[model samples]
Target: MATNNLINDMIITKRALPLFRDTNGFIKNIDRSYDSYFGKSGAKIGASVNVRLPNDPVVGDGPVVSPQSIAERSVPLTVAYRKHVSLGFDTQERTLNVDDFSGRYIEPSVNNLTGSVADIAMTLALGAANMVRNVDGNGNTIAPTSETWLQAKAKLTKQHAPTADRFAVLDPDTDASTVSGLMGLFNPSAQIGQQTKTGAMEAPLLGVREWINDQTCLVTTTGSYDSAATATGSVTTLSNAGNAIPGQISSTAYPQNSVIATSALNGGINAGDVITIAGVNQVNRVTKRSYGTPMQFVVTQAVASGATSIVVSPALVGPAADGSQNQYQTVDALPVADAKITLVGKQGETIRRNLLFNKKAMTLVTVDLMEVNKGVVDCGMANLDGISMRTLTYYNGTDDTLGTRLDVLFGIGVLRPEWLCIVPDIVDAG
Candidate 1:
């Protein structure tokens, strides 16, 4: 029969089997695998190493050393376990326990194993492209129409009324060209009447001319004048040289130069002929003025007693040459107006980020697992054992029966086999 002391020792030793080199060695192997798999630059993917034991204890009232005393005094060696495991830069570090393999780790690893590096790289590239396509500098998604120029003139005209002069002609000759260019920037098919349909109908009629000088003069359609008092009935007698017969006529009525009079005083004047007394100015000069200010219109309908004599409250007339022409013509006391472009929000940037993150995460996880699987198989275990040892095998029993058994043994510590199986060649089903 087995001694009670031996049975107790056996139990203790059996319990301590998990704490042996096998358990700690497995962790160390995992750490090395993780580092080699994820740590391209020699940084370990496993958590920081933490020793689970305190310093050596001091002995008091100790006797001479004996085999039993030594055995009793011997301390079990502590295990240095990795406390945290880093998945990647974007994710939070996960904590690990003794004999604890996370399903989360397995999923990431399987994803890495089955995934393609080239495909992953392509996905990341596409994602980055998507993100760049959607955003502006202010963290706002750029709208399709955000690049358009605001129609300032149209806005002002709509708020106010259509007037001959709303915008101050910066350069009257080039103003149309400037507006056309601005419109073309927003729309390639932009035209004067097409894009800006809100402006005044008579706006194009406004023109600029140089001001000669301020002077009053008469304008007559008739070429020459004649006197009614002349007796010779000759055209030459009525034609006056300078200072010939200044203001001798009693009435303003005069005669045309050549009149075929049937009876002199009672005869009618010929059509297209005019009469003017001597010493009256016979020339009229046209006046031109500067129209430098902006003007808005107010429409008002007028009522009249007769059909032809209606008095419109806001009468429409030919624009006068000067501001002093009429009180209604001058647009001096008017309020200033302005316009702006409104931008709407879009989801271009968000879509881009999501696409990029998903593609990259999938790729990285796949590559990591593939490398890990390769390493595990290289360590020389059973073919089915290699599949069972995979992290994903625990969560998903997709592998064969042998794989399931190996997975169970590793997870539950039921079979503490020391042998590690090498991985066989993996054939792509695709």
Candidate 2:
């Protein structure tokens, strides 16, 4: 009898084969170890798994795998299979398995770099304000308000008095008529005119008779000169020389024998100077003016039975004629500039871009002869699915006058969170 030809049949040896009870079960298990092997034929498998992995190997031919061994290998196996998956589930769940049977969870940690930016901004603002309050260079203790800082400026100027000196002349021998006539001659406006007699005869007329007496003398007086001279030959002068003259002129007009003295004037005080007057105690006033005129004056003169009015004089120097006469005034402190917040990155842009581009290729893959498989694909696609990450950055600049940094972040309202961390290239505590 002729048997049916069996062209494609052959005898095979017995060997252990990996198998699962159900198709879904096999697919899930194969996905967990995607980086290793799966299927009926020797081909790479593609599927996604949500898990963290170990640095070491999991499965091999030399060792019998235990439950503990499987537990330890679960991480690597999950990471390996984190990509290729069917579209039956949600996007997030598809790449990141979240079923009750899928053993994995997600946790978020603080990004210190982001938190640091916020801390720096707050600390800088406080420190700047404190610095402004403590500054005492010009003894101006009051910190300048926003109005003063923005709208006003320090200025210097000169001052003047209301009254000045005049001069007069004395001629002991001249008669009253002669003196009067001479005074008329010195008048600012005196003119000669024609004189007409009863006959209408006109002739050259002499101007108002003004002449210096035979003996002329000069005298200086602070008070107004009398127009009518009491002395027969004395002539009073009404104009001054216009030049500065320094000398002591004796005059019988002032009160004599009655003492005229200046009370001891207060001088510049040091950091520690204290005094008590009229039942009031005061610290030493900083001496702002030394020469020129007294900006302030305190009178201790005694009045009726020990009563006196302490005269207070507040004289502000007037605007100066030019820049040369400008004087500098002292102020205790001034407001300073604000600080800045910034961001930085550890890796270069090129490297980051490259990693992002090939994110899919970095994924895990598994192969098996029992089932069909595909090689490695995008790692991020396997792990993150539709989610993508974008890098952030920050930088700061300095402010000179206030020894602070420019606060660019808040100005733009970009920096909001309070807690932040920063990693700096340099640590300049000083």
Candidate 3:
């Protein structure tokens, strides 16, 4: 029997691209450059690609040229998420033209699939260590304002994030509230026009083009931990004291995403909780100067009750005594014995995460899923602008209907956590 040429998989994938791109606010803006390394065949889900980050530069005097070993670290981009949407077509529906069929089915399925992909990337915004707290310096809950964007931009700038291609993804409520707050009669005519026309901050506000995404993630509760806890005073490193040794900086220094033991953490820490340690101020990424503010961290692993250690991101590497490892250091000093630990939010409260970030800060890599045996089964596969989606059709003998499944395989990773800042909006607790 001749297969129905109208139900081609490649055709469906092509029809799906416009909806997919327009629907995902965060995914479309992220770094998809890693997709260039993969091809049409044999791309396994767990396979990884090493993403290279630029090394920090050093200053030199005029006398003689000094040689420095290249210091580089890579974040592995793995294709681990495989998400799909399935639908069935009866004899009557299959007879419709491709455009008609797409309007009925493809639009809704791609919209849903885009939300799932965006949700995965939205979680990275909550895990950001640098944040514009929901409260002001005086400690009152507040919606974001123009100053908030400036503060977030300042954080990104101090981290050496690229000044170009900045974007902001706001939760639905934040989008409305921020627009109301910034569109006062005294504001710029152009900004007011943008807000009045779009009903949201769609234009570049403080040099960041803002987008409203309903799929933004929320923090309904934080990790339960004692507010007055202290570090267990044990630094996990090889030879030096949480500092880098002369020749073995990467091996000797405390690494990011490593576990640190804490004392009086009777309630333990949650994976998304943000915390800070006393006297551990964040240093400027380029100049390595202390910002005089406590360095914040996002817990990456959950700790059970009575557990002693918590895993944190953006590792606690202090400046070495010799000053040679300043390029790799993140903190001004290691937590001293009994250093106070500070938790950001109360447990069981709700807050929506609104992300403000540079394009280079986050990445989304999609690989082409293996196509089905064309001679055996009808299938279609296509790649558009680095996003790969495939469709497969099979007959249900009992129901006398054909079913189609659309699938996308991809992964999400944070290239520079410091470049991403969260401007949280308070949500009333239930």
Candidate 4:
């Protein structure tokens, strides 16, 4: 009858943390160094931490101290997501031991929360500039291979992504397909032996730890605009007279992080669709050397039919010969006026987004939640390996029920989009 007779909040909190850590396959590999900043109280949604960007070195003459002004660059990692799972328990359920209670309640709560976080994090994948299509040049989707993974790695290497802590996450079907394709290639070694025993790819292969993540994104259709479009104008300069120029210039109102085109986008551009403009090649992050591949842009927002403009992510920043461009330069050159626009796949096609990246490419930050000390409930919060979760158990006298809720506050950020690549496969139908 008393609240004290309910399950131990502290024990539930502790058990939930391990379940959360072990359940996620994708978010576990992302950078979580920013978690330390949000461990305190009053850390609310929209709270942000600046991730410092590396500065370019200046070649100076003979210690003359000709000081070139340095501009500090940073990307904001903001806490903008809040999610929770609440469950009601009967009297008998509350008296169970910690393990029994955890397996019955806490494990499922943590697993649901984990999948929610991974889904939210997948939105950041749209910002990736490097895409290794499972489809061939003739534009038909195929199964992924070891060479597919290697292509993703090569893309990251060209962008100068850190070689260590790399990962590749595939959908279950793609994982099975890739593993089956790789089963006959390697000698009978421990890595292969482990995979063979598990009937799946569990070991690191081709410089990346492979994972099967059901949360991997799948898009059923892209933009339906079939014919090629032409850029109405050009992104002439990064800025004019120290003032950052808006994407919309003059009467040609190009949306921010978007392109203004001359053709009527019939079905319009859809979110998650990949597109490229002729002559806009990708460049290395450090050297700014052209990789000779057209820079890929993923649509981040939907545009209406007959619209002349479309939105995209990783805002176009063309490279410069001098170090005059912004530190976040993304492409070798801007689209010239009338540059041809080409979509990657057919108008309506299924795409499974399998991701590969360096750990620094993405970041996930979790923060401790504020307690409800004034409420008539038992509350406990726990932090483990940069993750914080809280459990609240309360009694409802009307229905005579015990309710427990688990809550998590977190944020996801795309740090180095160049370091993130998508190895997409077709989501085959039955």
Candidate 5:
């Protein structure tokens, strides 16, 4: 029972759970999340921010005698919800296999949790899709070079983004492909090499601190956005979109994927599936729907599948018009009708992403779900930078099923939407 005590004791889990640090892929080294904890004590579990900060006043010469008072600005703090994704497992004491349990149960659950966090953080960088002005005017591919670094740093500087603690999180595949050529440094040996364990490059270079974050930085194909021929050019509401469900490709044209309203998957695209059309030279993997823009795919709001048409991530980039010529074809495989499509792959590839940010852009916060301190970090009940793993044996009254759960609670908040820049579709050689 001594070992049992170790697993059951909350204190032991709090202190000793750290021994499993090396096992975690992304959570351990997320600098921004740890650094951006807004010190709000006893805040609610769900994320909601108050934005009463006043707009910058016009600068002028000081009054000779009396000073003019600007009108009192009273504004409401906009509150946004934090997405919570958890993974856990159950074990029966009598037949519990501790040796392999870690491999089967704990690792999978923890890995999912870590991966979810990575995905969440990545959405921040996805902001590039909608930037008022981006590094590339078209928001498409760019060959890597030191000038690329200068441009990225310049964007932040233009935004008046703080010069300190700034970072450029690179898409490993894109960076490896483009950065080297731009810097004129050829190290073929390191082409597409394995990303760092923390998913970041080791050194800071150029004018700003930089990181190669393969785990969280997303590289997705384009999705079909507008279909003028359809009754509705685009699906605006989530419900009409069928809660963003999986949509099958209706047909595929050579060198290009489906043409919206023409031959798109009638219906069968999963929300999280990373799919691509087989025949097209420029492959597209749909991520999510564009909330406002008809043709641009940006928003991540879940819309279940419906019969009309499917929406995708990185907003599938297609011809200007339905009958337009397919200009994206390559010598390799061209998309064919009903070609096989794979969901988002784990490896880095065509899509590109770079998140340059400071504290104002986004804030990450972790709270103890089980304890009732609300959102306060009081006792060691919930460790901030570390994870809290606990075991609970329970049964549901309905089916008498017994299970155990070990989960985590965390959130990445895009507080100041304008403060960050998500540069995607760059060509780099990391």
Candidate 6:
């Protein structure tokens, strides 16, 4: 694949990443505006939410005091690692028609790619805060119920998360339950039922608008999630400042199993931090083989003082991964260099990760445009809903063939970590 030389890349190319007409669900739900990130590497993305100041401590009677001036706290945001999707196709076969090229292939890919990116971003964010699971009067944990939604809402309420933008992303199982009258928000009688009579169910249960993210919803976890760090070691000490990713991130002293280590990036891991292990995924069902994906863990401890190796709670690995049983282990291994980590909070045990959060809890931060090119077919700057893409086609001189590719690039940045929480464990049809 050649680098996109927009200068040489010619016409018949469009910049926008077209999407499938039907699956615009995630696209319409997320708020994307380039007012901040455009033509830049990154920026300080945050907000000064309010003007109120902390209450002053009281003292015994004293002399007259002067007025004080204070500013609301400022929150900071950063772009996440860039993401992309690329494809190659026979140039002549697709020359049939541009719209045909887009509708048949590009649109569906773009739509799915967009949703997958959002889902991955949300997955990464789940580690930030895990919401409690709902249990019946019996001790058994139940699927997402009114109790689960309330618990998720409580997490944000304690953090002072704003009320207006609050939302809940329910998994399929829980979603079905809610729509089936479990939420206790609507009734078969009354005006609310009239909305259903017109063939639409009322949303915004418990003041949090609802969105279903089945395509990219979470279905990942481990057996022992609550155990504190079983083993601890100092892989490296994080230096406060550096121009690079910092030696602390790639320290050789770090052992292979899931153990405590220091975070050297500007955003280091903190207590209660639960992040996706780099290069890991949840257990795959098709093969009944977990390729060690969606590896997640809790941060039992973080040290900003003296030495700083985080205490990743729970024994991450055991005799299971060590060939004691001669079986391929899930989470192939512990996290590695630049494992994209998001503070998605935490959650109670569940197979599916249903979540409720404020809209401001997380964001897809855009950085540079990811485009593809070869010879003369040119496409330039184009974007949609805060996402940009480019495609190119040219002749393969050596193979005597022609080819084309399409791709997009962006990052995921969580603005407020505590504003979101995961409702773990909901059943999935797949």
Find the candidate with the highest TM-score and give its number: 3
Q: Candidate 4, overall lDDT?
A: 0.72
Error of 1 at 423 (Å): 40
State the TM-score for model 6: 0.58
Model 2 misses residue 190 by how many Å? Answer: 91
Error of 6 at 346 (Å): 13
289-398 per-residue lDDT for model 1 (tens digits): 22332221110111111211111111121223453322222222221111111111221112211110111011111011211233121111111212112121112235
Which prediction has more favorable lDDT, 3 or 6?
3
| Tens-digit lDDT track of model 4 for 99-188 | 677788888888998888887767656556677876678787788788878888998888788888898877877878888899899888
lDDT for 304 (candidate 6): 43
lDDT (Cα, tens digit) per residue for candidate 3, span 294-331: 88877765667677676676777777677554666788
Alpha-carbon lDDT, every model: 0.19, 0.17, 0.72, 0.72, 0.39, 0.46
- Displacement of residue 321 (Cα, Å) in model 5 is 41
Q: What are the per-model numbers of colliding residue pairs?
A: 17, 41, 1, 0, 45, 29
Predicted candidate 5 versus true structure: per-residue lDDT over 1-430, tens digit per residue: 1233123324323432453343332334333333224344334444433332234332334666544455332212211223322323333432344434455555555556555656655654443322221235643455445565566566555445667766666666655644445333434334224322333344455555545455566655433332121222321222111111111111110011222222433233333233333333332212111112122222343223244444333334333244322222111232334443332222233445556665555544454445433432222344535443343344555765544444444444443333455555543457
Ranking by TM-score: 3, 4, 6, 5, 1, 2
Which of the two, 1 or 2, has more lDDT? 1
TM-score winner, 2 or 6: 6
lDDT of 6 by residue, 124-174 (tens): 454343456665575445566666677678656654567777666656566
Measured over all alpha carbons after superposition, the RMSD of each candidate to the real structure, in angstroms, is 45.2, 45.7, 5.8, 5.4, 13.9, 14.9
Evaluated against the true structure, the overall lDDT of model 1 is 0.19
- Candidate 4 segments whose C-alpha is farther than 4 A from its true place: 1-6, 57-67, 236-263, 319-327
